[model samples]
Target: MAQRMYIVDDDKSIRVMIKNIIEDNDLGVIIGQANDGEIAYKQISSIYPDIVLIDLLLPSLDGIEIIKKVKNEINHDMIFIMISEVSSDNMITEAYEAGIEFFISKPINVLEVVTVIKRAIESQNLRNVLNQLKNTYSIDSRKNVTAPITNSSRRNTMKIYSELGITGESGCNDLANIIEIIVNERKTNNHFNKYNMKEIYLELNKRFYSENSIKTIKAIEQRIRRTVIVALNNIANIGIEDFSNYKFEKYSSVLFDFSDIRLEMDYIRGKSKQRGKINIKTFIEGTINLLKD
Candidate 1:
């Protein structure tokens, strides 16, 4: 079924333009529209839209206030895209705090709005799939009595890495472990650190207590580089087999930089001899963020 969306803007022309764009692009169907914030809240509560396009400044309650009231009192899982002319940090921050997933600036561009909403919807769908996979694994574990049920998150993480054909590589587990540690550290600090190879290696070295830090870090780096290359090659090979393979379509550029993936793809198709360079920090950080989500 097409996802239902609601538009809440004080301006009728803006609302109609948004509705027309959504319809033209076939992004989703807009189920309702409200000119006032309070009316939007009531209508949203009644319809339970999958997505909401709301103006930051509304007639009665304002966008942030309406979001806060709805999220706190009525619905919690609805996706919100804030439409605003005001770019004040305070207002943006407040909207984000109140659960806006994206922003559509004034003089809305059709492409940007569609792209942002589609990306958000895709993320939500991916999360739902992961949850279903986890639940299925849980059910199967309960039925079978042999091996103990491993951590589902870890299992899922490993499954993703395994799909890229890196499970047997020397540093794969080490990378996974360090990613877990980094994610935990982020949780503790309530913020994500902008990671560097040296800093990450130093942290891992502390945990593992290697005899020679420099040598061990170098070895670790090499191993991870090889493993990431393997993953890139795997995606490229999949792309070669079927250019529109869903796995390749979704992961080709996301797991690595697009330029790097393009290089790997060229190599796979026998167009280039230059090996793709994997950004180790980016790979690990992206994997950590992916698994955490």
Candidate 2:
């Protein structure tokens, strides 16, 4: 079944533009539209759209006020998205507390709106699946003491990392195994079911690396290492395939500046090009800019 969406905005042109853009992108069925909050409330109560897109500046009642009112009186199941030109941090925070799932700031690009909506839909669908699985499983930790996950979990995790282009991810395969072994050891000894991040990190390092973990923090080191590795890989393999014409044109500039990953990739073509050592910066910065939200 196609999902339903409702749009609420005071300007007719903005409303029309959004509806057309969404329809053009084949996003979903636009169930209804409202010029103000009052009309929006009525349509929402009667039609029950699966998602609601609201502009902050409306005619009578504003979008934020509408969100609060609807939550107080109507159902809270539908996802809410706040669209605004203003960058009022406090208002955005308050709207978040009131249960807006996401935001798209204006001047609204249609492409961005589509991306946000798709991401939100994906999240909601995943949540629904998780809830269904929880109801179906009725997990019993004591049933088989320490039975391993039956191949399915491993396949699923690998598939996920692969889909996200993280096949070369180091920690997911190695450090995580170390941590899992530590947890299993604790469980076998009948230890408590609680462990802090620092304690877990220390235990993992002590067990696997033969060195005490840092006392200062949580999974910060793990995240940094994994992210840096990913950044390095992405920058090196930035262009998925090499076009014969553009290989030495567009990518040559990228390679000339960042010799880290490109230099390594060069060695893969031993017969085609001469060999060279590839060493990415121990501390570099441009990589982070590419992966920023």
Candidate 3:
């Protein structure tokens, strides 16, 4: 079934542009729209769309407020995508903390809007599947039988790294090692958000080298960074060849920041002189999320 979406931007032009994009791409049906947060909250509560594209600065309640109210009062399952011209990190972070699945900056790019919406839909679908599996297996501990799931997840992770063109890189092993360490840590502590990247790298070095030296940690970090850059180049090249390629679509914004991917694409097309920046933490966290069964 096509995803049910709602538009909640004050600008009618943006709403029209996004609605046109959704219809043209056959992405979904727009079930409702609102020019202000008050009306949006009312319509959204009544209509219960699967996804909401909302402007951050709406009259009366604002986008984040609407999300909180919907989540708290209505108890509906809705994915929110914030549309804004604001570049302030704190505001963006606040929007994320309010439960938005993604954010789109103003002066919308058609390609970006399409890509992000598709990604959001795909992520929601995956969550649904995972939830179904959890419900099926939650009955008994002995009946859990997670070996097949574990193997399948490992294969999928390896395939993603292969598609990113990192399978042959030396740091591929380091990346795999990091995933293993995180999985093990989560099994014990139930989370790994407390540790920083530097600490993770130190732990990785200690696991392999029996000692945590700065030089070893630095070397591991450099290898992983270089490998990640190579993956970025490969993704940029794939995107240049075909923007709608499956691998390009799947890994572009999920594994790295969408802005960085766009910058890399521009550099590959010779439209820009600078290359993209790499965030090891984002890459690792994204991989971990994908690895989850």
Candidate 4:
């Protein structure tokens, strides 16, 4: 069956353009559309679309309110993608917390819209598969199963590093070691963020080096930073070539700030001279999040 979608933007032209893109790309079928939040909520509740592309600001109520209502009141599975011109982080965070899967920034870029919608559909399908699997399997059957070493977190970390184009870097091992250490600590504390970068580096130095020297700690930091920079550049290059690339879509926003990714992408395109800033802590936290997911 074709995936069902609904558009809830106030602008007629925006709705038309998105509809055209959906049909042109054979992405999905638009089941309904609305120019007001109250109407949108009613329509979405009635039709139960597989995905909804909704504007942030609308008549009657706002996008966040509508999403919250539907999620709270209706017992249905749906994906919500917010369309907005707002750049306020607080509003965006609220939208995310309200259960939005993605954001389509306005004035919309066609590639971005198409890519995001495709990703949404992909996510919806994956959820359906997982649901089916859950229904088909028994908890007792799963209890005795053990994942192979090849499927371990360490291997998964290496696979992700390879996808980010950092597997060959000198600090790849150090990065993996750091993640392992964090994972081990998480088994007890669970609040991995409580440990700072300095403490992490100190732990690594104590575990691997003969002497607890500041020089070794600095070297470790520099090496990991350089490796992370290489991963950023690789992601930027992938984005420049194809914004819809799965790796680019998945890691760009999670591993680093989207703004930094954009900066790196622009620099690669010769549209900007400034390079992206690397936040090592953000990268580490993001990686751990990915691993957990």
Residues forming the 10-long window of minimal summed lDDT in candidate 2: 284-293
RMSD of each: 19.3, 19.6, 18.5, 20.1
Segments in model 3 whose C-alpha atoms lie over 4 Å from true places: 137-293
Model 4 lDDT per residue over 43-63, tens place:
776546778999999999899
- Model 1 misplacement above 4 A: 1-151
Per-residue lDDT of model 1, residues 145-170, tens digit only: 33323455567678888777666544
Off by over 4 Å in 4: 1-151
lDDT per residue, candidate 3, 1-293, as tens digits? 45768999989999999999999999987767889899899877654566899999999889999999876665545689999999999999999998898989889999999999999999767754553343222122345433322345456666779778766554666677677778777889876766788888887776544345665576666557756876777787788899999988877887889888889888767788566788888888888886763
TM-score of each: 0.46, 0.45, 0.48, 0.48
TM-score between model 3 and native = 0.48
Against the reference, the lDDT scores of all candidates come to: 0.72, 0.55, 0.77, 0.80
Error at 96, model 1, angstroms: 63
Residue pairs in candidate 2 whose N, alpha carbon or C atoms collide under 3 angstroms: none
CA-RMSD of model 3: 18.5
Pairwise TM-score winner, candidates 1 and 2:
1
